[model samples]
Target: MIETYLPNVDWTKMWDATVETLYMTAVSTIFTFVIGLALGILLFLTAPGHIWANKLVNLLTGSIVNIFRSIPFIILIILLIPFTKFLIGTIRGPEAAMPALIIGAAPFYGRMVLIALSEIDKGVLEAARSMGAKTSTIIFKVLLPESMPALISGITVTAIALVGYTAMAGIIGAGGLGTLAFLDGFQRNREDVTLVSTVLILVVVFILQFAGDFAVKRLDKR
Candidate 1:
């Protein structure tokens, strides 16, 4: 029955699609982490009683994070069409999809980062400040290092979320396993292809989750 269902399908093409998905997911994850870390640090440092506390900066950053994080991914994708086009000169493909993914995931990661940083011991921060550490020095040396495990977990979560978002990007011509499933299965009514693609995506996500969990466990002091 399975043989009859998926006979002679071009799996090589599907494999290629999977590779593209990985590439897109990886690049977007890196960009999201960098941007989130910066914003998160900014949010933390500017919060009340911190070394660089600035009420207005904190409010603005908090507001932007909340606003962007609240916008649904699909809607954000559609809403960002013009911006995507402006950035990539085309609004349909991995290139176009990347900016959207970065925008959607970065602020979310920022909040996660802020939460992680805030979880650190306040006394530790005070000690770092008393040692004549600059704001940048404290963030890099004290907050980030102390919160490494939590940050790792956050990255793992963000990576998994990006996988889901990339699947949705299929609707906009972004080539990935999602596109394969949509084009070969949903649109064409090929259940075998759809099932296979679904399984592949699940496997990929599970692997990412496992790897992330392992890293978090290894890094975590608690």
Candidate 2:
């Protein structure tokens, strides 16, 4: 059955495409996690009831997250083309698509992170404060560690979401499994390539979800 539609096409090429997808997804995920976690921490600390609460800071962070989250990924990609080209010297590959992915994913991930942090026990924070921990110490040593399980889950969710974004990036010529699928399946009318790409994407998502769940369960005391 596999031989019928994809005949004579190198399977290794598909492997290369899959590697490209992983490359884009991994890089974007790391940047998004860092940026999102930082923004999330800021939002939590500056919210009305937190120790470092400041209305202005809270408002600014919230506004920035909302602004980025509101922009559609495809539009953001097109809108960012000039900047992407400037950074990457070509706006049609995985490297070129990265900045937009980071921009699109970071705010959404930030909001997720904020929610996870907000769910941490208020009592734990108070206990940390009573220990005379500084703000930075409380955030890094207390809040972050306490929310590890939730953060792990959030990272899994973000990874899967970014996979979808990577597929869309393929539309703009970012070579990956998606691009191969699009060209062979959509443009060239080969259903087998499409099927293979779809299955590969699902496999990757399942792996991410399983790994994330395992980490969360391992870290979660309750």
Candidate 3:
């Protein structure tokens, strides 16, 4: 029986890993949204036909977002090691991984935001302008409010992606369910431990999706 050969799982370790993973995901998501929302707004405003309409600004910012988004998460983590060390004093642990997680997710989420904002009706902006709305008013009142649902859904997606990143973060000593899966499960040949960690990650992601969707439905006017 596979169960006969299966090693006993350390549930306390699994619980700890669950907590760490949640903490990392929550902190990283907050950081990503703060940075990404600003970039996304800039991208929407600076586009060729958009309100700002600065060619140089659009190209530079768009290029930067693309470059960061194109990097694979695993390699991105490696590339961010020095920056991480500089920020947090060590290249290991949840705190250190925040930089990598934020950097990697922010740009990707920014693009999602760009798409969300771009999809809004041009008439909305036109009406706001006709009403003598200032740029700040257009952005705060019109742009963001119209795209709130999409933004919520986009962040929901980003949170799910961060779940994957958190697991990989464990490879570099960024503690989480990932570390348990690696060191205790695969390295020790404890399939039971591996299965439990994997299951927990699924549960977390599922809960995020359900909660995010519920909020989107509640907040969405349409």
The lDDT values for all models are 0.91, 0.90, 0.92
What TM-score does candidate 1 get on C-alpha atoms?
0.96
User: Can you write out model 3's per-residue Cα lDDT over 83-176, one digit (the tens) per residue?
Assistant: 8888999998889889999999999999999999989999989999999999999989999999999999999999999999999999888999
Q: Per-residue CA lDDT of candidate 1, range 133-182, in tens?
A: 88778878889989999999999999999999999998788989889889
lDDT order of candidates, top first: 3, 1, 2
Task: Give every collision pair in model 3.
Answer: none
Off by over 4 Å in 3: 1-7
Pairs that collide, model 1: none
Ranked by lDDT, the better of candidates 1 and 2 is 1
Clashes per model (N, Cα, C within 3 A): 0, 0, 0
Q: After superposing candidate 2, which stretches have Cα over 4 Å from the reference? A: none
